[model samples]
Target chain A: MLRLNNIHAFYGHVHALRGVSLEVPKGKIISLLGGNGAGKSSTLNIISRLIQPKEGSYELEGTSMLRKSAGEMVKHGVIQCPENRRVFPLLTVEENLKIGAYIRKDKNIKSDMEKVFTYFPRLQERLQQKAGTLSGGEQQMLAIGRSLMGKPKLLLLDEPSLGIAPILVREIFKIIKEINDEGTAILLVEQNAHMAMEISDYSYILENGRVALEGNSKDLKDNDEVRKLYLGA
Target chain B: MQIIVSGLIFGCIYGLAALGLVLIYKTTDLVNFAQGEMAMVTTFVSFTFLSQFEMGYTTSFLLALLFAAVFGAIVHQGIMKRLQSAPPLNQLVVTLGLFMVFNGLAGLIWGHKPAGYPQAIKGDSIKMGSVFFTPNEIFVMGITLTLMLIFFVIFRYTKVGLAMRASAQDIKASQLMGIKVTNVFTATWAVGAILGGVAGMMTAPITFLDTHMMFDVLIMAFAAAVLGGFLSLPGAVVGGLIIGVFENLIAFYLSPELKLVYTFLLIIIVLYIRPQGIFGGTQSVKKV
Candidate 1:
């Protein structure tokens, strides 16, 4: 339900995103694949309004998000689970999750918190413990669970499995699929092409700040160039 | 024992001012070198309300706190906000500039002469075993402890408090969670200035209201914050008490004139042993 057209983002002298365009249809998991510095993170950051784009139109369900500030994005339900799991290191896990619901004024916050705990029982166990003390895998869970506390319509997952153990990575991907099935659209940025291809319904391959390839995940999986460059098959 | 009790009374005042410094530093990452001058100005404002306007002590104190809150918001919104993204050095210089400006302004408005200020409470010294305390000293410590408790509760239980803590920890992440970080910063300054104003009012009775009265307290407060590890609230209070007790011990055992020198030396030694301050964790270093 999100569309970014001809977006160009700059970081000082460097052109981080050059005329990049992509779309995430409602209730779908759209994976963007790229190597390091291929503008994957830049695309997510631009969508989250973390970095301003000098030229482009970003719309969520036909509503222009250009004027909306970064803090306003979450109110519109475009929540981002930022890269490196930016959990408040000093705050307790419960406190971190409570902050996730900062924009909500409804009384369902306690229920929403319970729902997050249902998804991540580990967070419940460490509710009072500081988030910085969490293991890498648990931190990832806390990050995602924290974002879910915002009741995101379009969840932006940035490297959720990065630096995580292989076993935990599988579990995380499983949760991603489960989250998608439950109707929240996901824009997942991943370097693990194999797991990405397996779960994503559609995929875009980014190279040098442009959309180099785009197709259905199954078709993209079988493409020779895609297999060679990303999947390493 | 008397020395310790008296030291703690002054320590509570130092801690009160340091709480503001730590709060502002935690939320905005700006070391407000001007905090002492700000407190001095607020004390002057209280004096104006008390004597010039013929207001009662309680009314004057509240009015001063209200003025401090508005003054803080104005300073942050009108000045500090402009330098939000500037280099830390530039920010430091700006606050130092504010220190000079506030100091000069206070002198221009109130004159340079020190004046007697009324205490919140008036009574003979209360004797407890070998220790004695004026009603004012007990009042200062009692109010400071109560304020600390209130601050801690608000920080722990409230949504705004959660947003504040979250923003302090990670501004970007808190924004992503829909916290209006600018509002948090504004609230931080307001609360910080209120705490600083309280320090000024409490100290004025003992030190007398003067443009330079808070100068010594500011240095000690900074030392206390550094000792407390800058990021920890409880650390700030404990650090203030440590500095107070240490200074008092030096004054009693050694030459009184050498107290400040020995206190600084002791701080250097303690910091050399624990660079992060007493409660500062490994996550982030203090900017100043």
Candidate 2:
């Protein structure tokens, strides 16, 4: 479980997150839906400790996380599948997965890798192939699979559906739901509002660095303003 | 045959020095202009151990390598680490600054005059057909080959090597994977400096130890790195060897004075044709 209180982040003179607050409950899929420059990615970045909020109380199950570095966040089981599948281009697919478990000293890494293969069988077929040579869909799978290798309790996914084909996007969303069903808390940032609302239990709509709307996914999906603005119904 | 053999011996030295430059550049994306000076200082350290402390040649050599490793780590932590977030031009300028500092310090302490340096193994040159190999030449080749083999194994098989490769390829992605990228970078600098120190020690006996001992070798090593494709480790070694033999051939058959000009011309032509060098990947032109 993760909680943010009045988090305000800045990029020089530009205030990116203006008094934004949110919560991700244990074993739940929480979607943060927003347009461009709405601070969706910034919120995910803050949770992952990639960017620090100038003003905020960030807590992971009651322990303050503001002091932790981005590298230390992974050790705390906060794995981020960053935007645009940033797999190491020169390294093999197998090496990319191994690097994900960089902080883990357990003997179960091989078994964990096997578990990832179950989620993305295509990756197993191309284990020795360089990651850069993978197709966008395959790269996305590798990115998600790589994060799973960390055995994260809290997964921060920033725009998993971006640039992905519609058919494969559905497949990835299906796997994302399955991952959440298995008990990992997910904070998904998405532009694909229809799919995100369909999968997520709770949703927050952000506009101009502020939370404009928050409700159960079902209620938000049926809301007239949400349908007109995001869902395009 | 003699020209090629001598060229190869010198090539091994350039390759060893180039290895350090390439390693640091690959991981940190900063071309260390001070690599030659670092090696120069380390050689001076070894000379002091041998002459002043009366240490054995082996002891002095190993101690110099150890000193290089620590010196490299300190340089990275103290200076390079601070410049990590700065612009690439700034980082490069800092290394150039370090070059002047190290060169000045070595001159101040060791004096400007060249000093005779002992070879690792002093013996008669062994003849094989038309070619003759000195004991020191053999030692240099053996050490270079061994270090190359060791580096190959480490890069291909070790965890640290994987981290280094990952970090080199994508720093942000490596961080997401929980890799201590700074530590990997620090390790690279340490290993790279050790390689440079080995090169300096080997080169000293042939050229004589002085503040400017590594100047020509460093330039040749740069040429080698460019020839091999700066990104590839094996490429740097191959590039060094090619430059060594080519330079020697030009000196023997053509004109020694024009060898440097020909070398650069050859590089310019190769780069003109391939752009990425021999071992480098084709440039990925990103869409704006």
Candidate 3:
């Protein structure tokens, strides 16, 4: 489980996250829904310790993560599949996947790698191929598969389906659900409300860097304001 | 044929030096204007070991290289690390500043006089039907080739190498995957410094050891790196060899004074015709 209590973050003169709070319970998919500039990515960045918060407390199962560095966050099993699938374009897919487990010293890395291949069989086919050469869909899969190589306890996905093909998006979401079912918690940020709500256990709708609404995904899907603004009902 | 053989021998030294520059630039995005000075200081450190401490050639050489590695790590951790997010221009200025510091420090410690540098090998030039090379030159070539091979193997097969490539391609993404990017940066500086140290040792025998000896070599090495595509390691070696041979041929046929002038002219032309150089990738290399 993870919690962000009354967090405030700023970028120079602009306020990004203003007294924002949220929770991600164990082995659950929690979607953070927002339009542009609603601080969706900032929340994830803070969680990953990429950017320091102006004021807040971040905890992972009661262990304070507020003072940890970005590099340390990954060892704590707080893995992030960053925005736009930032795979090492010049490296082979296999190399990229290996780098994902950079901090782990366990013998299960090879087996975990096989587990990733099972989720994205296409990745195994292009193991030796340069990641840059992969198609957008395949690159997204590589990005997620690479993160899975770290054996994330709490995975933060910025936008897994952005710029992806519709068919691939469906496949990716199906895998996301499967991954959660297998025990890893997920914090998904998306502009695609309908798709995200279909799989997320709970949802938070962010408006202007504030949580405007939060509830069970089903209830949020049927709520009048949530339906009007995000669900496009 | 004589000119070609000699040029290639010298080129190996230049290529080794350029490899250091390229390695540092590829990973940390720092041009390191101080590379020459850093090598010069390490060379002096070895000179002290050989002269003051009365150490053997092998011991002094190894000790200096070890010192260079630590020196590089210190430079990165103390200065370069802080400038990680600073503007490229600022980083450039900092390295240039270090160049001055190293130069002044070496001058104050070793004085301005150039000294005889003992070669790893001592013997007369071996002459064949058309080509001749001294034992030291052969030794230089052998060491350069060995180092290059070792680098290639480590880069291709090691976990650290994979992390380095990942860091070079995407620093933030590599961090997200749990890579201690700072560690990669430190390791890069250490390896680069060692290469520079080897280049310095090889060069001192020919040019004589002085605070400014590596300056001219550094210029040539940069030109070679630019020609080879700054991001490609093999490009650095090829670029160095080409520059070496080309400069030698020019000096043989044309005015000796015009050798460097012509080298610069050639570099300008290469950039004009193919801005990416011979092996440059489509993405413009980040200028250090």
lDDT values of the candidates?
Answer: 0.90, 0.92, 0.91
Worst 10 residues of 1 chain B by lDDT: B279-288
Candidate 3: CAPRI quality band: high
Per-residue alpha-carbon lDDT of model 1 for B1-288, expressed as tens digits?
999988898889889888999989988888999898888899899999989999999999999999999999999989998998999889999999999999998889889988999999998998989888898888988998998888878887898888888888788898889888887898898899999999999889888889889989999999999999988888888888888888888999998999999999999998898888888877545443
DockQ of 2: 0.79
- Checking candidate 3 for backbone clashes, the offending pairs are B31-B288
Better of 1 and 3 by TM-score: 3
Using all chains and alpha carbons, the TM-scores for the candidates as numbered come to: 0.95, 0.97, 0.96
Model 2 C-alpha lDDT per residue in residues B40-142, reported as the tens digit of each score = 9999999999999999999999999999999999999999999998999999899999999999999999999999999999999999998999988999999
Ranking by lDDT: 2, 3, 1
Alpha-carbon error at B134 in model 3, in Å?
2.1
Question: What is the per-residue lDDT of model 3 for residues A67-169, given as tens digits with 9 covering 90 to 100?
Answer: 8999888988889999899999989999989988888999999999999989999999999999999999999999999899888999999888899999999
In model 1, which regions exceed 4 Å deviation?
B282-288
DockQ values per model: 0.81, 0.79, 0.86
What is candidate 2's CA lDDT for residue B125? 96
